[model samples]
Target: MHVEEVFVKARFFRALVVAVSALASSAGFAGEVQVAVAANFTAPVQAIAADFEKDTGNKVVASFGATGQFYAQIKNGAPFEVFLAADDSTPAKLETEGMTVRGSRFTYATGALALWSAKDGYVDSNGDVLKKNEFTHLAIANPKTAPYGLAATQALDKLGLAQAVAPKIVEGQNISQAQQFIATGNAELGFVALSQIYKNGKITSGSAWIVPASLHEPIKQDAVILNKGKDNPVAKQFIDYLKGPKAAAVIKSYGYQL
Candidate 1:
């Protein structure tokens, strides 16, 4: 090869190498973050995680369950990098226990309680079905571990139906299972997160009376980075993405308030 041609090739090769390095650095090596998500926020988190993975070229490994269970798991050193809790208190409790990153906790969504049934027109809009007491069984999460379950009991208490409805109650370990009971006809009707059966400004299927927020305590969903995720950049990115406009739109579509 001619000397001039050799020089030109060397320069071009160096430029190519530099360009590749820059591209790789900008994109980074695709990393994955393990996230523990609350059961009620399942749909919204799945939607948001899809967008997050698409936009950032990262993977979100999410496990959905009740917030209190997740809290216990985290305390026992579950390998979760982030937590999306159904209520603000679990994250706060984790923060206090040094299980999470400091100042990383924030409310992600405000959930609504819903009285839902898989059968069409089975649940009245005003939630008179609870008062009517006509169903063979009613489903609720175990109030001891699920915030939605606590909210359900609170609403029952407010309506003076706690004792009357206690006998026929069937309990699920988590809100998702409680919903499954209704969906699979294991129970005629149940209390579930509004987001579970709601979408695009309405219930997705069956009948639901959106339990008035005034009937129970506000369901403030929160998120935080766990100690396991303290050094993971993707953990912060996921939370930041959730706090952005795109994720907020998805959350709202599922009947959650930001």
Candidate 2:
């Protein structure tokens, strides 16, 4: 080849190599963050994840389940970069146990409970349906593993119906499942996250009584960066994103308090 042609080819090859390297770097920083989210926060988290992806070019892979289950999975090294728990205690425990990045836990949202029935007119604003004791079954999350479930139990006890309604109570593995029981007619009525039955500050479907927050302790949903994600920039970004205005707006719209 002519000397001039050889020089031109060398310059072009170097440019091509630099371009490829730049693209690879971008792809590396835009990698996915694995997140474990409590079932009750599923809808709001999904919305936040979508917006985060669009804005930052980073991806989020979320697993929705009971917070206790996620805690177990994380202890077993489940590769989750972050955990969004339905209660504050779980994340604090993880932090104390060195399972999460130190000082990384924070309350992301405060969830509300509601007494809901798929059948129209079955539930009232005051939750008198529980006192009437007419429903064949009531669904609630398993109090052992789900914060919402614990809250449901508290509310029932506060209403003086815990013992009276024991036989008719059906337990779901998670809040999502409890909601499903009510949705699919497996249970005539149930206590669920207000977020599950409400959107835009209103109940979208079904009859519901917004459970008074006074009925139980605050369901302070917490988020933390797991130990495996301490060094992950994207995971840190995601945790920060959860505390930002964008995510807070979505959480509020879903009937949660930021």
Candidate 3:
């Protein structure tokens, strides 16, 4: 009831308001972040994005496709604010061309390859199914454009089945399509990213042979803030969220190694 009490209460309220405003600014205003995601990362990124939205109050707008196609789109001035590439080289190329924020690039995952079939138990352990060469059709992404496709080819070569399997190969424009080929039975089997059909520490469907790391060049996937996203706080925030434990866990759940 005293003047001093009233003044103290008013000062407390003003200080509380200032603190709240500062906290909101630091937390960042809620905004939609547009990200171009690699096809192999579709499931993982979707899970991570959901957690990111819940944690940061920012919406993630993700477009999933082949990395090379997305790179071409970026060069042609796509509206994507962030790029999650299937290979490190593409992001590095963008950085060289000044398409990304300086020092914003980092490897987010080391991709693993899998030999899979829509048929249960069709792909034997250790990937000897490729050597059998009995399948009517085998699906693979375009090696020139999809890094996973390149890895698939290398795996076949290492298994010494490239020449024999050449006649049976059917190609997809990207990994997702390659997977679809097998899923729809258009191809008997296919090589796909392990993440595509794996989750929760197991294969989600059919059967798969996880290609050994020594079969081909390591697939180092990277993420970077694109030029359009450099000034967007939500973009940076999303990337930061991806680097956190929550994102890492989701990525791991999808069979990707962080």
**Model 3: per-residue Cα lDDT over 173-227, one tens digit each:** 9999999999999998999999999989899999999999999899999999999
Instruction: Show model 3 residue runs off by greater than 4 Å.
Output: 1-29
Candidate 3: residue pairs that collide: none
| Local distance difference test values of all predictions, in order | 0.93, 0.93, 0.93
- Candidate 2 lDDT, 3-41, residue by residue in tens: 999999999999999999999998877878999999999
Prediction RMSDs, each to the true structure: 3.8, 3.0, 5.8
The clash tally of candidate 2 reads 0
For 111-170, candidate 1 gives per-residue lDDT tens digits of 999999999999998999999998999999989889999999999999999999999999
Name the lDDT value of residue 4 in candidate 2: 98
- Misplaced by over 4 Å in model 1 are 1-28
Model 3, CA-based lDDT: 0.93
Residue 178 in model 2: lDDT: 97
In terms of TM-score, how similar is model 1 to the real structure?
A: 0.90
